[model samples]
Target: MKLRGKTCLVTGANSGIGKITAIELAKQKARVVMLCRNEEKAEKARQEIYKVSGNTDIHIILCDLSSQQQIHDAADEYRRRFTSLDILINNAGIIAGNERLETADGFELTFAVNHLAPFTLTLLLLDLLRHSEAGRIITVSSEAHRFARFDMEDLQLKHHPYSGLNAYCISKLCNIWFTRQLAALTSRSKLSVNCLHPGFVASNFGNSASAAFKALLILSQPFAISNEKGAATTLYLAGSEAPEHISGHYFKDKKIKKPSKAALNDAYAEELWEKSAALTRLELHKVSLS
Candidate 1:
């Protein structure tokens, strides 16, 4: 389906694969709402998107995914501006390395931004998304999830020595789990939810790599996909016709891939969903699937 006149919101649309995906979506005539944390950076990227695509319909709102209050305000502002939404892309994420730190909300920075922020935002947007003929939730996950499973007892990473990549891996795993849970909840609803690993995109996102990972980045950067190439799969999931009936699957290069065993566990998905609701203190009234 052509995205012409369709409204889509892409978190972290100002850079990396998210930036290219936003540009491609705009090229398809979709009106994009870029949710970014930094105003100056977002505006610069916005202008670049407009300059290249000649699509002046792009707008920006500042919302730091690391903070709960900021996410609420961002969602409120977005709802106030848009009507009849079609797509919601949860592409914002982070990796806090070298030192363990928490967001203003007292959650690990990586977990907060990479997992909880999108989870919270999606719940808030369900009402608007359900208003559409069909809605899509494209969560940008990572292959790193293969390294770790959700530690249900310590979702906050308070008890153990923190490893940045490990935290990031679990967060991405939560992304897939969230997708499955949300999709199951909306099975009879009009919305769809799916997650993807961008295939090791050559982006600056790994700059915070724990000293150990920096070497890995240097070694892998040469073989990593470019920004536009990395964005192709996301663009397809966000706008392609083939994915209309698909939901809760992990995708790469426009195809479904087998996720790790942990990602497919119904029990874990449910546990994570409940834990997330408790953490955010947000109740999502599930629509009947029957």
Candidate 2:
């Protein structure tokens, strides 16, 4: 599919799969908007994308996904600058340290950045996306979700023992649940939403991990795929025509794959949607995709 006239927004576009995805989209002449946290890093990545793709339409909007206020501001800024959105990629995530951390909104740090931020941002931009001819929402989940122990009562992991690996796993599980619920909500529309496992690219994704996790990452570096290879599935979902009408599914290696039984629980998915809505203070009754 041609992306020349498409408008795509990618989060965490300053590095890793996000940066590669942005660069590839720009190469196809898409009007790309990169939402990043660091101005310096974003500018550097923007320049690199421009130099590589020779597409000067790249724009950057700095947003720290950990803060709900910042996410709101960024969404507003995006609306002010753009009229419609064809593709929205929620690709930013982090593995917090062993010590539990909380965001400004008082939510667990891992959950806030990996799940809530994208959940809130997507809802804010739903109208714009629905306005497009064909809208797609691609979230980068992980296979690590298979090990997640989801506690609906303690979604924030407040009562459970906190560990970086566990927190990261749960957050990824939320990503799949979010994608499924969102796809169901937009099924009657032209929008398509899906999540994927990006094959553990050797990047700085583990920089904020705990000492043990960081060491594990270091040990696995030689076996991990390169950033370019890791981004293949994301770019496939973004640019290919194969998945235009496919929604509420998981992908790995650019093909549909069955997620864990937990991810397939419709009841759990609906509950998660409600919980996320409450956390984001979003009035679900007012949200209309049709």
Candidate 3:
């Protein structure tokens, strides 16, 4: 898909893989929307993309993904401003410190930002996406999803040991589950949804992490790929031809990879969708899967 006239929104575009993805999309002449938590950082990144891509149509909106209210307001504001959306990239995420934290909404921090934020925002923008000729929803999941196993009894991980790594992995699994379910719902519509694992890049990913982990990330930076290299798969899924035809799949290195069995379970996906809808107070639309 040529992105010359497309409008694309990218979350967490202030730095890391998201920034590079937005810049490349802008280079393709797509009107880029950078949704970030910090206005100052987002403005700087927006200026950088505008200068490098020579596309002055780049825009920025402040959105703290960790808060449900902020995401809802941002999505509504975006709808009020833009008539249609061609692409939505749900790339914002957090790997909290070793100690578990909760968002203002009382849900676990990792789960709220990494998974629920995308879930709420995408559903809110479904109509605008349906209005477009080709609509794509690309979420940034992680290979760490393999470490997650669905536990209906303890969905919040309150009963289990509360390690940040476990929460992060579970949230990644939620991303894949959400993608599969959304793709199923929009199968006959113009919208297509998919998720990917951008490889470990040398970026500021763990700034909020524990000191030991931050040190480890710094030490591993020399071996990690550049942010631009890490964002290759995202750009492919967003701007390449016929990505809509390949929806409901997990990708890495621009190639489809099998996710965990839990990620592909139809029942689990549906359950997750229902739970997410309830948490976000989002009205669920009936999807004619027949």
The candidate maximizing TM-score is: 2
Candidate 1 structure quality by residue, lDDT tens digits, 60-86 = 989989989998898889878876678
- My TM-score estimates for the predictions, one after another, are 0.96, 0.98, 0.95
lDDT of candidate 2 over 1-290, digit per residue (tens): 56898999999999999999999999999999999999999999999999999999999999999999999999999989988899999999999899999988999999999999999999999988888888999999999999998688997899998887899999999999999999998999998899999997997899999999999999999899999998889899989655578999999999999999999999999999998988999867777866
Model 2 poorest ten-residue lDDT run: 236-245
Q: List pairs with backbone clashes in candidate 2.
A: none
Task: Let me know the TM-score candidate 1 reaches against the reference structure.
Answer: 0.96
TM-score of 3: 0.95
User: Whose lDDT is greatest here?
Assistant: 2
Alpha carbon lDDT of each predicted model: 0.87, 0.92, 0.87
Q: In terms of lDDT, which candidate is stronger, 1 or 2?
A: 2
Better of 2 and 3 by TM-score: 2
Clashes of each: 0, 0, 0
Task: Sort the candidates on TM-score, descending order.
Answer: 2, 1, 3
What's the residue-level lDDT of 238 in candidate 1?
A: 81
- Record all residue pairs in model 1 with backbone atoms less than 3 Å apart, i.e. clashing: none
Over 79-189, each residue of candidate 3 has an lDDT whose tens digit, in order, gives 788888999999988888878788899998988999999998888777777777878899999998999854855566877887777788899999999999988887888
lDDT of 1 at 289: 35
